[model samples]
Target: MDYRYKVVDLFSGAGGLSLGFLQTKKYDIKVAFENSPYMQETYKKNHTGVEVQGDVCAADYADIVRRYGKIDVVIGGPPCQGFSNANRQKNHAISQNNKLVKQYLRAILELQPKAFVMENVSMLKSEVHRFYMEKGDEEIVKRCNIPVKDTFLHLLDGAFLFDGAIDIVKDENLINQYLWPEADYFELNVIYKSAKNISKMINALDHHKKKLESLIETYTNLKGDDHIAEEARKAFSAIKAYYDGTLPADEIKSKIEPSVMIQRMLSKAQEIFQNNIIVDEYVQGSDLAAKIRSFAVYDYLKDILTAPENNYVIYSDVLCAADYGAPQKRMRFVVIGIKRDISEKIALPKGSYDADEYRTVKDAIGDLEDIKPVYTLAEDKQGIVLPKAENLSELASTLRDSPVLHNHIVTKTTDTALERFRALKPGQNFHCLDDSLKTNTYTDAKRTQNTIYQRLKYDEPSGTVVNVRKSMWIHPEHDRAISIREAARLQTFPDSFVFYGSKDKQYQQVGNAVPPIMAKAIAKKLAKILSKKRNADAKKNCTKGNGRQSHKRNSQHKHVAYPQH
Candidate 1:
């Protein structure tokens, strides 16, 4: 069976969301809309399967309808300039009519896909709520008869929307026309029992289990009597009984006896096991991680509420990228929406690695040859590296003249500075520089000159990459700033992904581009979901005796791994 759905990506920046969606292999990317030529080139190179359109605002909705017929899914992050925290500090006002964000919403309305994924900074949530409050209040005042103010009506409407139970306006005319009007509002009440309680119970159980294990370990280490193990088990049982509310707290405490000693042991056990607990596996940095997780939860609720209709079922599974042999600590939110009337949830395939075979940075980029630094003599007698070779250079170079050239160049480093550089590893920072080497450059300057620069350590994960031009990213070994390639590698872009633009633009794109591995993992999850949906659709068609021929495809496609050179 050909289990695939079509996807349209809007405001597609270097194809992060598009890449994630493609990972599932179940969705065919039909079109991608982006504005920047540099980003368009990068997106085109990575996503040859999709039609990359320029400037989404300039693209006609009729053209999209004409080409795709009907998009199954729409996924994109609208430009977040308004919602960015940095912008918030600059007294810049966010116009509600930002054509870019509005254009994205317009596409969603036009396409009317089965589902659409909108990602933006967490701040957008507040913006949305605020808009709803203002517009919804005005709408209620114009429409509702309740003497209560517009805010109350808006709240009532929201409550009804969430509860999926409309009160049916007593007015016959309104009920007949507006209330339950042609299923415009789908029933979406999904009861969500907090997972927190269950998770807490599990933590309590594990905590006691660990306590017993520690006692066992201590007894074994001391060659004490085996009876101590039994004692530990009994103590754990008492705690469990207390946790389950089967025994009174005072009774459990009395039964355990010597409360002080028990507390001491528990504290010791907690200390011993503190580092072992994996509190949260999800890596920070990706802007959409939390939203995706929240959406998964929301979808689950949506499914439960609409279960009676048996129209849609949302299938969810937790998948960690590390398990799939991804070299980084990448966790993803995966959701599969299936038509409940047609098929069951699809089972996720097992990941490719065991604990012992976890992928690492070495596996991702060890083979790439390191570029040696080349220095050229400056007119002032000091030396600096030519940013690019003469013949290949196509763009104006932006590398600034070195401030060190203003002073007499010191060929020989002081013993302390040499020791500091020697002590610096690939990712070491200025903090590692010895006090003697810590120069007094700031002494002659203002407060703004107090910023310190650090060296990048080659062997470790790079610090969070950004578009700033501070010299903080200098080489750990060499005094020069890190090359653009190194920054891209740090961001986990693949070696094959070539950026085309000015040096600064290249930096912005690299810093902004989603790590391909992260994108791949997200795509894989999305692909799994789309596959499930397509399978459901196929089953429905088969039952109706209107089946299409199967499209047997190759099992393997060329895959790109991360730590781009």
Candidate 2:
């Protein structure tokens, strides 16, 4: 049975997503749209025989439609820098990168694909960082209602009342117990409930205060009737004191009008579906009138996806790479859209491993040939000898078996920085540095991320791997940052797939790649649905008793995996 379906990958960085679909032998990858000359070379070289389009932005849709008719799938993660939280610049909204998402959307609309897959830095779902979608962005902001203030803020506000008390009580540990950010406030049961109660109190108090303020605005404080002025003055003072915390909770109960609290929540709900961050997983967004404009996509799609209730759209929880036996804890967000004619719902395969069974950093990179971690700042490892591979774990074996290594090069680090790496324990980052070693002006040691300059724990899945050229990601057993091959291994790139370019470009290619193992699973699920539909059509044709044979399958559709150089 031929299950081949044609696909076009936009923003096809190094063809990682294409590689995933290729592995299933169920896809006929027709075109990959990438603009970078170096990345284009990598995709064309690794995904041999697939057509690599130079830049979709410049390509004419009419010509593309004429050249390749009936493109089954359009898939891409548009340039994420526009939506990325890491881009702290206020002008991120106007970055040319932000406009690239529309380019991706344009491809989908033009191709009219049966389905599409978009991979993005999970922040696309948030309102925190704002981006201009089009010319009339101001109108988008004007239409948004002031979101009832976040209750989680109220929880922290309420719980904060105890921070000083706990400090005085000499129980600093208690603060950690109650203030733990183990999950978003939306998911934390008590935190959300507490915030809900506080929200209602704030709303009621604000409403009354606004009313009294309006009356005072119309009638000068002296012009108001004496009793009326005295009553309004007392109400305002009582509400203000309640916020100041001097009036106490019981006193606020008397001072503020109590409204029905927790209207947003229902009784005995099994699941509290919340707009948690873009999971896969991570990130959130913010602001009042301006912030709500970012949810234009969410509000527009949400009603259509949910109101039909025909199971046409399925909202799956975030997919964690560790759960799928990947050697890293990389998380990602995914959404699937099926054309009405194909299937009603998509079934995600259950995760193959639990947290305890997650593949580890050791499981991924342990058997690689080792190189001495010491290197001068200008050292280029063109002839560095590598140690023999030993102690191969079963998982590591699947990633590589060849004795010859490629891209086994590390960045140059200073002797002083090496000493700092030595000081950090496994999984402890710059935050754990001693005062003498810490940057002089860096007062907030706690603000340091645990993964920065931290050694990977041997038995745990590594966190998201980024370009470590200037980063402080230390090798688990060594003082230096991980080599390119090691980073690729952690990203699950097979040994045969060698990246071509300068070391910087190679690292960028690896850092930007989607984990192949994770992508394959998604491809397999989509393949099953497409295959079933094709089979059903064939059977129906047979039942019609046509004397003619079914359309012959194309011989060229048979694909060969990429050949080694």
Candidate 3:
């Protein structure tokens, strides 16, 4: 069989991966998947003849296969905000956003591509969120009464469970009757609010005999509105007495089983103190591990993605873009799968350069130093063309792939802001400002990192160049923020690969892309491996065909003497 090595890019942002793979001149990128209108237009503009689609979930793979035959490889970077370290509040709902990863998996399963490469934020590989998750789960569970058997409850007229005790049993219809939400026994409330029904209370369920006896004694001395506590005491005592007496096994089993209250604090050797609990112990008490483990889809895919049988291998690791020669320091979790039946174990190329020899901000934008930029005229919101360059480094030359640059236009600023920029040195940030110049952007004026209004350091590698329109990343030498063209340069987008959108949208597209240069190196290496496999497969087919021909010739001449005859 012959091979063409076609590729499908999922979650394709701004065509960075496509550009890199094109640079390899190996596989043909037949289709790209990007939902953003601006990014879609930009990709279409740069890489013509490729089909672009929106919505990965709604993608019609059968149609794609007809247009472009069996896709050999699938590559892309899914949205990472759900697992990004920068997100302080991580939860089941937030992590649910990672369903995009599962969607990527769906493409692989449906297409059964020969190989796949995926990237996400690095924090996905870390367990740091466990501590916070466990804490949150424990608190939530406490507020929600966990049953001894984990069974949900049936309400008076509808479906409801764990409508536990009120945090405070309130005023009632009568003096003796305690008030609960909705009065009919199930509160018209949310999950968090449902826990107020007292049944979930830890004190209510813990050491029933002793807690009730103590409470009973206290209740004897209590005055007005002590009826709720009295009723709790009587219930606990009755349950304890019922357990004390022997009942038939079936009878006991049929009846409600006793469940102790859930405890937030834990115990160690001969010690019991909530105040003494440590971080490690606190985290262990949570179901956070279970929740997080549940959010992950790889384990579920293992059964579906059988190795040796499926002819491919799927695995992942947290990779640094810096390792791939990206000018900025970026860490992303990369998931790679190689179809062994099509090729050998796919080893991603080792980085050519290390930190000490990292590509710097200067290497990325050195040639544009002399060029001054003007603000947009609102009609041409896309920046002015950068002047022709001179004395470009090898890295710069690659980044400036085309002679014409599209986003060289600068944003306009006031005199005061320019004056503040004059005070900021290359490595120094807003902190370097004098007391008079230091505005109270922060209440304490000391609560943030130096990066808030920091300028790029010329010699050092740049920080992650995010959407600068919002963050307003200052230029190293210039008074204003770095221009869109400059930001793209830092991102290793070739000069010719112009972005098609409003200035803000263009900046976002540039910021979101994988460094094309780094992506190119990866593409180049993977292409080599695939190319090697294709050649080997072709050679095997040739030998097999020759063998068949030889056999046919031998069969025709049944014996050697027959030919002579």
Candidate 4:
């Protein structure tokens, strides 16, 4: 039997990254961790013989070694929704999703895998993406020499809100310090209100639950208000779970903190409008600390991972999925790390295709153009017969390899959606629609992204495949939404791989996945590096006297090929 490197996948959503490593035929994915039950089902079914665990936060590295033996590689793209550019409400607090990046690092530090790969949103490379210094991070921050800065929280908005107050100031630059007083008071007031509100909610759980239930019941009997009903139902369910003591402690905190923080911020801002003069003395006191010292996430990662104790050679760069032959222009920041003892060098995977050779929408899903998708969830396996074509694109051929297709289901559309879908031409979006057609769709129709209500152009690659079902992404030539399978194909997922969940969950799984084609390129590169290291170790073992190995495996290497990108 050929030697297959053992692999462990963290945050293994829908097994897209693992699928890529599997495609290399050089990796044996022994275990995976995914928190979502739907994703866990899909991953378990697809990646047979792999142990699927839940909640990477609660994972025990020692137990894993005892059961699965030594792991060779660790690969995963932790949740990056917190780092997405679309998130407008960036704040000083590190989001729970953002904290998963540190958990990925924890896996590396504990498992001490020969090589590890991590991927996240391209925005992570920006200097603006950082972590606020917590009390625990102070010692590490100082020891790592990571640069820290004092950022005035919740003051950026005050710059505009207090523009009138600013014009009266003699020095234009003094406006920031002048407004700092108001910002500090604003933050303190919000904090106070939030804490009070949380206590009230916890104390009056029955009252709030009854209120949410009443609102949900009222909306259930109404028409043209499904979205509002859904929101209410979600809230009621959460409150019910919390009251029943079924919700996790972290979930309870997460549910309460964000909503309380945002609501209190807005309500307090209005209550304290122009009332800062009375509290100016309080703001200047030690209680109101407006300036928060923080360090960049990228700098911290570099400093900690490259430290002498970790002994890892790490490389990071932004990689485009289209550059790796996927029909989507999705860009992600990728980090590859190799044990320094295994090799003193490390490099990121180079893209094989440039702009001209990028795959198009037609190349990806053109074969499925004639097949009508089911309007609702049906059987797990559906028969798919492709139309006869003389020249099938390589991507399309790979996508059609399965004997049967699954997830070829589209969300049923309303008349308004069908109208908007028909009105859009190839490459057109919601902005091109008439004002009447845009009603009740978004909070701000003008601010709606062009990606929403988009009609795919056959000749061009699609943009990042977000939850296209929510976007209402239309077909290129047909007057319907793109099916789940089409979106998967655009993400370079072969038809043989089936998604197991509701239509919405299936779409989310596809959107959240790292394109297998891009993942395969990365896995192949790592395989070569590991294989070469193994060969070098074997050679050194022979050279040692009496054929005795001096040290444990992966501990002997002093030099190896690690070409820079």
Instruction: Please identify model 4 stretches exceeding 4 Å from their true place.
Output: 81-93, 155-289, 379-389, 545-565
For model 2, residues 1-565, the per-residue Cα lDDT tens digits are 6667889899999988898889899888888889888899989888998888887788566675677778887777776353333332121123357557668756765676777776766655555323433344334234443122211111111211211331221222432332212222122222222232555445444545544344333323333433323433444455456556677534554332111111111110101112111111111222101121233333333333333332234344467777777898777766566665688776555678888888998888887636553233224334344455667787877887555566777767777788888898778877778877765323254565666677777878888888866557788887777887888889888876777677788889988888888888888888888778878999988876453422222322333323432
**Tens digit per residue, CA lDDT, model 1, 282-360:** 1123110111001111222233323453244454455554565444444443433444443444434467677666554
Question: For each candidate, what TM-score against the reference?
Answer: 0.47, 0.64, 0.67, 0.75
As for candidate 2, its clashing pairs are 127-286, 128-285, 128-286, 280-331, 280-332, 281-331, 281-332
What local distance difference test score does each model get? Answer: 0.44, 0.59, 0.60, 0.73
lDDT of 2 at 97: 72
Better of 1 and 4 by TM-score: 4
Assess the local accuracy of residue 556 in candidate 4 as a C-alpha lDDT between 0 and 100: 43
Task: Give the per-residue lDDT of model 4 (tens digit) for 198-310.
Answer: 54434444444454444434433434433322332343355456657897323554433333333323332222232221112112132221345666777887888888888
Regions more than 4 Å wrong, model 2: 81-95, 129-294, 298-317, 369-391, 401-403, 440-446, 545-565
RMSD of each: 25.0, 17.2, 15.9, 13.8
In candidate 1, which residue ranges exceed 4 Å CA deviation? 1-4, 20-25, 81-89, 95-103, 119-363, 373-427, 430-460, 468-480, 490-492, 546-565
Q: Which should have the higher TM-score, number 1 or number 3? A: 3
Model 4 score (lDDT): 0.73
Q: How far is 195's C-alpha from truth in model 1 (Å)? A: 51
What's the CA error at residue 315 for candidate 1, in Å?
10
Question: Which is the leading candidate under TM-score?
Answer: 4
For model 3, residues 327-360, the per-residue Cα lDDT tens digits are: 7887766666777676556666677788899888
**lDDT sort, best first:** 4, 3, 2, 1
